[model samples]
Target chain A: MPIPSPTVITAATLDLRGRPVFVRSTGTTDGPALILLHGLPTSSWLWRRCLPDLAEALPGWRIIAPDLPGYGRSAPRPGAGPRHLGGWLHALLTTLGVDRFALVGHDLGGLVALTDAVARTGRLGGTPHPARTGGPQLERLLLLNTTIYPAPLLVLGLLPSIVPPFADLSLVWLGRGGAARDDDRRKGYVVGMRQLLAPGTVVEAVEWAEYARPYGPIAGWREARRSLRALAWQAPFVLRCLAHLGDLTLPTRLIWSRHDPFFPLAVAERLRRAIPGAEPMIHIIEGAAHFPQEDQPAEVARLIAEFLREPR
Target chain B: MPTHTPVRYVLTSHVEEHGGRPAAATHAEIFEQVALADSFGFDALWLAEHHFGAQAGMVSQPLLVALAAATRTRRINVGTSLIVLPLHHPLMLAEQLSTLNLLTEGRLSIGFGSGSAPFEFAGFDAPFDGERRHPRFREALEVIERAWTGEPFSHEGTNFQIGEVRLVPRPTRPLREFAWLGAMSEQTAAMAGEFGYGLQLPRGQSADHYAAPIGAFRAALRDTWGPDAPERLAIARCVYVGTDDETAIAEAGPSIRRFYEHSKGYDKTKPTPAAPELIERLHFIVGGPEKCAREIAAFVAATGISHLSIQPIWEGLEHGQAIASLRRFGAEVMPRAEALIGAERAAGVAGQD
Candidate 1:
């Protein structure tokens, strides 16, 4: 008859320009906001394992996990692009009455977080310094397994894939799971998952369904297509964000996976070196691939919470 | 002897399979108990790892349990009571511990055992004989320590051959891994002391059995590290306090006996003294709160080991039963135990004068 009490996580939605943003939150309402963002093909649920611990670690902080548009429960708009994604997220947070908050983002979510920071700093093509250029005061930031700045060749390859015919084919081939020769429809998603998840780790069927659900339909694929196109065109803007990365004048820690397929340890090391700050500790998560957040949530949460709690 | 050191309490849990009870249920209870221990301000919490036994222990992976406890509690140090190190690849173990250390904010402590169960070792396809175990544990410990250094190193021992390997996501502090060894004899204790590991001693042994190893370790520690250094040793005891001594015996004796016998069938490490006289002599704290406090205080004074780990969960001990005793120990026993130890210290100081 003995069982641990369930953690109290409230699922709610916010209206941003007529589109609803799905969010799961915990801790006190008036506490300092801590926004958690998830990467592509995964939604706010990816942060599920870390949320409870995060809530435990920072009792006075509000942990907000929102499903970006077209990801989980959020409705994707027709014209929403990568540029609009950050704006939409900022608007959603503002609507929630969160003005200043710490941002923790993973993978593509990390890229989105950078864009959001850069846009706020108003340094599209301006001289930037961490101390001088900033809109809202960023209390802290944690970037995981993401590189806002990419090698030109990497971007060049992705650039062609985002073009019309290629983008359409790429959407089918890369979205949900991936393109398959028809053994199992779920196999495409499984293959993608295998690449993302550490070997010897098992994901329950239900959990896989939650991640693959978004890419199951034609509408989902269309939304992914638009998100991709946005990413491809916003290359220059992303580079700008990368340029003014020092505009983030707060304590930041980059937690990266050593074996990440897309952005390996070298990418995180380069980013860590380039990031101008007195308080940046680059930690490499061992034995994890692209999604260390999901692979080792406790370790990921531990590093971030410790950095946040530690005096700078 | 000076009773100046304030005895610190730690909670140890071994979720034994109770009469057809599910393993999952036992695991759930343990997590809750650990969280409560953390909130109650216990100094630390340690876990029991078992494998391939018929309902002896439900938790086979203490590292996984430590990870779970880290998420649940904020301040409590999480450690394994004894991880049978011989069964695992040293590099893999090192990687796991290093990553866990980073996660726990350097609050991770490791305890290694030369595994005693042949079947359990066989399950992992590892060499399980006594002849091989000592060598394996020593070699494995060497590799684990080297891996924590975060430096590219190689080992060319008799058992292992590797070339220029460095662990990634290394421990934050290079060349350091906080560790404990639940060693059984003076030789092992000396090794543990020489290597700067905290020595962990379990209960159910003869009262005299401990002092020898501790003394040997102290001497070895002094020889290796210098006389000014402090020795850290943690002792585990079986404890249950009832309203009165008679009630305590009636309530806890049978369960304690069952626990020892069940243990005897497995874990061929140390022989436990279960005779009534020996049990009393070994000082299992089964009595009223006042008597229990005095016993614990006396034991602390004699041993000079400040850290006390109490096994609240055992074979035939229900979850609620353990909780009741735990509450009484914290609320009633700890304060009195401290007061008694203080009085002893005062008496010693006055006698010296």
Candidate 2:
């Protein structure tokens, strides 16, 4: 039987190396800081819509939603690609004095956030940056709308040097015109994001306006391209660090949006083979796309909150 | 962009009283007046700062003025005409501006300046090296911007070292307002142009003095920087409008004198006393709606100025008269001015076709 979890929601922005990174926190700040990294073209704003519900179920954890570079209010990275990307994430958390966290990645943010966690693992062990070692040491890994393929097999292409304008005209074409759409199915999206052992019962709306608010003028298409291109440099680190996935022995959850355009569900079994002892928690949402937060938000939040509450 | 609801008048205010008006009293008065400006249909209001005065009540603080302006008005965009940058760290300014932006829910503009007055920098230990001020001002701006986005940063340069300083409580929107550099000289104006920031030209400079800077700004924006460069360019000019020419002249004359007198710190050459016609012709905006509108249009065309900040309330003008004048500007002047600039922008966009 699925266990029930509580949900919470809050909105805020944090500074990341002189950049304004907008964040949406779900759950309590006391239990653990779950830095939920958002995927391509979307921002921490995506979590906002479901934050209130997710917050309630995860009573003691703080859920953070930060607008990664070149998305929402966060400007482009001062330097390009994975090296600076990992450093910036480390800098962002370090600036906040958050020592340890349970790293969760969705789509692009998942890959980047995970890579940074692994790169800074030494720093998290009292090496160079002393303050980084004290808190939660990447206790668990939650990957939603993600692709962990090692090389040329990755689906999405990377961020380009010269991106075409009007890249986002498709989202508008897709009919997400700031008005709430498809009210009925959101419950499932919420259930997935909760990390409790038993999924919490939640209303369809997850702080509706908060998550939608940060998507200014739709730079997601451009951000997706950039984030994917970023993987070229980031993938090696990911492959290397993720190589240590079996060694850590932490519970790894893969909440896959089955209809995701980028990551094929057929790869799930392959993923299990790649990371030994992966302990995969497969969540296949029927009608969701690459961005489960936008496509199936409530369920994603519910699954995350429920997963976090489970006994290891 | 929201619909422009016929803004006819423009007003500019500053804590000009040199000895720094008692913060509490000034705060109450500014807010009270600004709220009234919103209700009364004023288009825009600007607040500027000058530091350290023996008696003239120098209101050296820019962030404080922005805060007061935020609480005082809604609908009207409040701006800092020039926040003397060298006097304060840019990171602190960024945080203050971001907080003020949140308070206003996004109606804040940060106007930056490299302190010109030797006395103003004396207290802060900043040298009066005019040559160094421009570079220092640019670097300081970078530091501030860096702090706005994230954790502590270390920037090593010839003059300043920004080390491990983080700016918390960032604004809801990052770099929303147009960041303008107050350019009293061509060099500084060119620097602002190079950086793709807006330019706030001084009130008294002629079209020729402005031509080089404005030209530099446009060339840099179009050729050097991309088209997405800061789209707003504005200059400061003294403006007062009323019914017939005489009525307008009657309201503005004495106030113009005081404004000019106060501005003497920057322009040491005393303004020569002139006849009424000369004052109306060159220095002030006076007369009926048609006459004022024509002057504004001509000024925009002559300078290719996309925006202008006008001072409607003077030191001696009655508050009632000022409000009435603001109403006139909002209803009459703004339409004409916007149309003129709009046409210019449209034509420019058309030429792109």
Tens digits of per-residue lDDT for model 2, A1-312: 877554445556676657677666665555577787776545677566567766665666677777777765677664345545656666676665565677788766766655555555552232342325453356777777665566322434432322222233343335464435333112212333332112332424545333333333334334445555666755655666666544444566667664454455544434544554455324455346556665667667766766777776
TM-score of 2: 0.50
> Pick by lDDT: which candidate is best?
1
User: Candidate 2: which stretches are off by over 4 Å?
Assistant: A1-312, B1-10, B17-29, B40-44, B54-58, B223-225, B257-275, B278-282, B336-353
Summarize candidate 1's per-residue lDDT along A1-312 as a digit string, tens digits: 878456689999877789888999987786578888887667898888888888887878888999988878898876465466666766676677775788888876887876776666666654442323333345677888776765632453366354322234454654444433332434445556666678766778787777767655545655655666666677776777777777766567777774666665445555655666523335656557777767877767776776677666
Lowest summed lDDT window (length 10), candidate 1 chain B:
B170-179
Taking the tens digit of each residue's C-alpha lDDT, what string does model 2 give over B1-353? 11222223335565334234465764455565667667756545567776665224345665666666766567876777777888787777777876676777777667788866787788888867967777788778766654554434455766777665656764443352457788766777766665456777777666666888777766655442334344456777666778877878766776666555555453556564542644554567777777788778777767666567776555555556666776677677677767865676567678878
Put down candidate 1 lDDT per residue, B301-347, tens digits, no spaces: 78778588898877887788788878888888889999998998888
